[model samples]
Target: MHHLVQSSLMRKKSMASSLPKIIRHRELHGEARQLNRMTCRVRLDQLECPYLVEISGVKRLLDITRECIFIGLSNDSRYAVGLLYSFSDSHHSSSMGHDEDEAELNVIVFELSATLLRPVKILIFCYIFYTFFLYIY
Candidate 1:
C-alpha cells in the first residue's frame, strides 16, 4: 500500500510539469551561427492571431521562411500578441579598420515547409498587415 501511494505521488508530479515550454528570448554569438547552418521552426494556429509558436535550431537550409516579427489577435478580441526579434551587435578585434572590421549579425531566420491550417494563415495575414501599419504610421 505504501509503494502504491508513492507511485501515485510520483505520477502526479510528472503530470504537473506538462505545460507547454515558453521561450522568452534567445541569443547567438559569433561563430555560433557558423558552427551549424541551423533553421528556426515555428508552429502557430491559423485562426488565432498571436498564436503561440516555437523556434528551434535546425541543421538544413530551405526556401520557405518566416519574418522576424509575428503578430496575431487573441481569441478574446481585446488584445494582440507580437512576437518580435531584438537585435544585438558583438564586436571582435581585427587589424582591418572600420568597413573591414565590421561583422554583420544576421537576424534569427527560419524556413517553413509544412502546410499551415486556415487558422494559421489568417493569423499570419493579420500579423503582416499589423506590421505594415506600424511601418507606415
Candidate 2:
C-alpha cells in the first residue's frame, strides 16, 4: 500500500511537468467573440482559437485608435496579445496616425496550462508517425 501511494505521487508530479501535446503560433487578421450577457456584452479583440478564458465584471470604456494584434490563442484563462502601439494609459487620436519611426510591438502572457489522460492517445500517434518515418526511409 505504501509503495502504491509513492508511485501515485510520482505519477502526479510527472503529469504536472509534462509538455503540451501541440502548439501553434502568432497568426494575424481575425476576430473571435465568446461573451457573457452582462459585462462583456460589447465583444472586441482579434483573438483566434483561444483556449480556457474567463473574464468578468469589466469597467471603463475607451476607443483604441491603434491596433492590438492577437499574438496567440488564450489557454487556461491567459490570452497572448501583441500591442502595435505605444504603451500609454491615455487614449489615442485617430488623426495622430501611424508613424514608422515610433512604431512598437510587444507580447503579453498571463496564464496557460494543459493536461492529457493516459498514454493510449500518444502511443497511437507515435505508431503512425513511426510508420510514416519508416516508409520515408
Candidate 3:
C-alpha cells in the first residue's frame, strides 16, 4: 500500500511539472450559435480536422475584426495543440456589400490537458509544392 501511494505521488508530480504554467496565442473560430453551444466547432476552410477541446485552461478569448479570433492558451494548452497535425478551420468570413453588410463568423473552444497521451510530430515538408499550389489556384 505504501509503495502504491509513493508511485501515485510520483506520477502526479511528473504530470504537474511537465506542463507549462501558462500558454499564449491560441485562436479557435466557428459558427456563432454553435460556438456558444459547443466547445468545439469548425468554420475555417484552411485546416484539416476537428477536435474536442476544453477551454478552461485558456486564459483569454477574443473575437477579432470578424475576420480572425485571438486565443491565449496556457502552457499546457499549447502543448496539447502542438501535438496535433492540424487544427480544424476555426473561422472564416465573407462580405455581401459595401457599407451595408456584416460578415458572419464562428467561435471554437478547446480542451487542454496537463499531460500528453500521445505525442505526434508534424512537419510541413513541401514549401515549394505549397507555393506552386498557391500560384496555380
Candidate 4:
C-alpha cells in the first residue's frame, strides 16, 4: 500500500508538470465589456452581390471589388470602409492550403460609427479546415 501511494503521487506530479501553464488576466478600463458588445452581423444580400454587415446596429454594405473588400456608408461614397484579410505570418507555408497547417486568419474590420472614427478591430479566426472539410464532404 505504501509503494502504490508513492507511485501515484509521483505520477500525479509528473502529469501536472507536463501540462502547459495558463495565464489569466482581466481587461483594464472596461475595454473587455466594450469589446464584447461590439458585434457584427454578416449576410449575403444576393447572389454575386456584396455582403451586408451590420456593425454596431448600423447597416453597412460591403463589396469585394478587388483583393480586399470595401464598404460605403451613407452619402459619402468616397470615404469607403475596407476589410483586408491577411495571414498572421507571411513566411508560413502549408500543404494544400489547409487551415491546420496555416496560421490564424486575420480580418481587419474598419468602420465609421457616428461622427467620430472608431478604432480598427482585428478579428482572428483559427480555422481547423481538415475537420471541417472532412465532415462536410
TM-score per model over all chains: 0.22, 0.25, 0.19, 0.25
What does candidate 3's lDDT look like per residue over 1-137, in tens digits?
99999999987544433222221112233211111121222222322323333222222322222323334433334432221122222241123121222222223333443222222322232111122344554
Candidate 2 regions exceeding 4 Å error are 19-98, 110-137
Taking the tens digit of each residue's C-alpha lDDT, what string does model 2 give over 1-20?
99999999987544433223
Q: Which candidate model has the greater TM-score, 2 or 4?
A: 2
TM-score of 4: 0.25
Error of 4 at 21 (Å): 54
Question: Between the candidate structures 1 and 3, which one is better when assessed by TM-score?
Answer: 1
Give the distance in Å from residue 18's predicted Cα in candidate 3 to where it truly belongs. 3.5
Cα-based lDDT at residue 75, candidate 3: 36
What would the TM-score be for candidate 1 when compared with the true structure? 0.22
User: lDDT of all the models against the reference?
Assistant: 0.29, 0.30, 0.30, 0.38
Best by lDDT: 4
lDDT of 3: 0.30
Candidate 1: stretches off by over 4 Å: 20-47, 51-83, 86-137
Clashing pairs in 4: none
In model 3, the number of clashes is 15
Q: Can you list the residue pairs that collide in candidate 1?
A: 39-58, 46-119, 46-120, 47-119, 49-72, 49-73, 50-72, 64-112
What does each candidate score in C-alpha RMSD?
Answer: 18.8, 21.4, 16.9, 20.9
After the best TM-score superposition of candidate 3, give how far the Cα of residue 114 lies from its true spot, in angstroms: 6.1
How well does model 1 score by local distance difference test? 0.29
